[model samples]
Target: MRSFLYVPGNQPKMLASALTRGADALIADLEDAVPPGEKETARHTVATWLRSLPAGAPVWVRVNSGPDGLADARA
Candidate 1:
């Protein structure tokens, strides 16, 4: 069975640490876990981390529910 571990996207430390965990996938949370002011930073951080992760480990960003979420996640 696959499992996804959630980590706050704005936190570099958590992002770095999550990469080392053996979960089947990771959810870099840009939503509820992050404060409103940190949303943009989280998006950038998650995007960078997504690029650096190994080929086999799937990584996803959980965007906020607001109208800008999709745009922010893609940014």
Candidate 2:
């Protein structure tokens, strides 16, 4: 990918605007960029955001490791 943009998962506005930024890849970050208390929220938000996109949306999610990461993967 030519451009890899990191968008904080907890920020809905950013997530919505990210897809149009012309980045080759969009990264929904739910780890260090998000507060501990917001991890779950970010997960749900990111999942929904990804789902709303069309089949060709270049999006990827970066989640914390362990249970949270596994859960994020499933999302």
Candidate 3:
């Protein structure tokens, strides 16, 4: 089992840096790192980034949980 490091989905620079770190998996975090106004943007950005990774490299998305703002964030 390999560990995944949490990287802010909204920060393109950080995401790029993390992808190159040789981690077994990367966790593109849309929950804590992004502010309410940037949730949608972060989701899209993370989706795009995940698509670009190599076949063997795993990318996981950490979405917001629960109802209210958390649910909205996941949406």
Candidate 4:
């Protein structure tokens, strides 16, 4: 079985610490986990976090839907 940890896309500190939580995979959430006002910030934060990770890091992203979601996917 695989374990996954969910980290909010808007919270940088939580996102940072999630890597060490012993989960088989990490899910950086950019949708429901983030408030509407912070959506853009969350996208940037999640993108930066993804870039900072080492290659082959077991991570996945949860993006929003529609045009805004398209922006999230692009990020």
Specify the highest-TM-score model's number. Answer: 4
Candidate 2: misplaced stretches above 4 Å? none
lDDT of each: 0.82, 0.88, 0.77, 0.93
Local error of candidate 2 at 5, Å? Answer: 0.5
Q: What's each prediction's TM-score?
A: 0.83, 0.90, 0.75, 0.95
Tell me how many clashing residue pairs each candidate has: 0, 0, 0, 0
lDDT of 1 by residue, 7-37 (tens): 9888989999896788888888888899988
Sort the predicted structures by TM-score, highest score first: 4, 2, 1, 3
Query: What's the residue-level lDDT of 1 in candidate 2?
Result: 66
Residue 2 miss distance in model 1 (angstroms): 4.6
lDDT of 4 by residue, 1-75 (tens): 389998999999999998899999999999899999999999999999999999999999999999879999888
Off by over 4 Å in 4: none
Give the winner by lDDT: 2 or 4. 4
lDDT of 2 by residue, 1-75 (tens): 688999999999999999788899998998889998988888899888888999977877788899978877777
Worst lDDT run of 10 residues, candidate 4, spans 1-10
47, model 4: CA deviation in Å? 0.6
Name model 1 segments beyond 4 Å from true: none
Write the residue-wise lDDT of candidate 3 on 1-75 in tens digits.
476788988998898889678778888888888898888788778777777778977777787876534654544
